[model samples]
Target: MENHKLGRAPDFTNACIVMFGVNLGWVLLFLFAIYGLVAAVFICLIVNHWLNWVAVRRRQADQLYAGKTPG
Candidate 1:
């Protein structure tokens, strides 16, 4: 019962569904990459801040031991 003259046109719905799935996969990958970068930057910042704090405290302790005003 198929139409011989039209030859059964291609299925646009299936094509659209495939494209949507591909685009969704790419979007998820990009999101995960961005999240990883943000997490790395955040951890670096926290470590840098902690190291600076410890250095300042050590410097203050040295100054106090030398009987200075910690200027």
Candidate 2:
């Protein structure tokens, strides 16, 4: 079993799967951002989503590891 501290995909396999989408989305969206305001919004959205995912994952894993069901 692996310890997923920081909500980083649970394991190497999962991490790769998750990062593939993240990287691909970033590349595509960066190209899509033609205007300055649009670019800022895109970047903020990307970063916010990533941070939320990390925090949520970490919390869930912590709950599960401590023998509590993740809600």
Candidate 3:
């Protein structure tokens, strides 16, 4: 005989469901405020420069490979 009452899981198991009232924007602002604004901007600029450099390198590699490889 199979018992149906033992088959169900607990409702309060997920942590996200428990924090339903939290606003993520406020949390982000709190983090940014704890860190200085100038530092944040400098980090963003460095990341942007790195991403652009990588994209340029990838483009050059693609062009070089495209010319040599036969389809």
Residues 28-63 of candidate 3 have per-residue lDDT tens digits of 456579886775566667767988999888888887
Clashing pairs in model 2, backbone N/Cα/C closer than 3 A = none
**In terms of lDDT, which candidate is stronger, 2 or 3?**
2
lDDT of 1 by residue, 1-71 (tens): 46546567787998997997688567656756878667656655776798899999999999999999897
Error of 1 at 58 (Å): 0.4
> Would you list the C-alpha lDDT of every candidate in the order shown?
0.77, 0.80, 0.65
Q: What are the per-model C-alpha RMSD values against the true structure?
A: 25.0, 10.2, 11.1
lDDT of candidate 2 over 25-50, digit per residue (tens): 77657666655567767776887899
Clashes of each: 0, 0, 0
Residue 33 miss distance in model 3 (angstroms): 2.6
Deviation in angstroms for 23 in model 3?
17
Q: TM-scores of the models, in the given order?
A: 0.50, 0.49, 0.49
The runs of at least 3 residues in candidate 1 whose Cα sits more than 4 Å from the true structure, single-residue gaps closed, are: 1-35
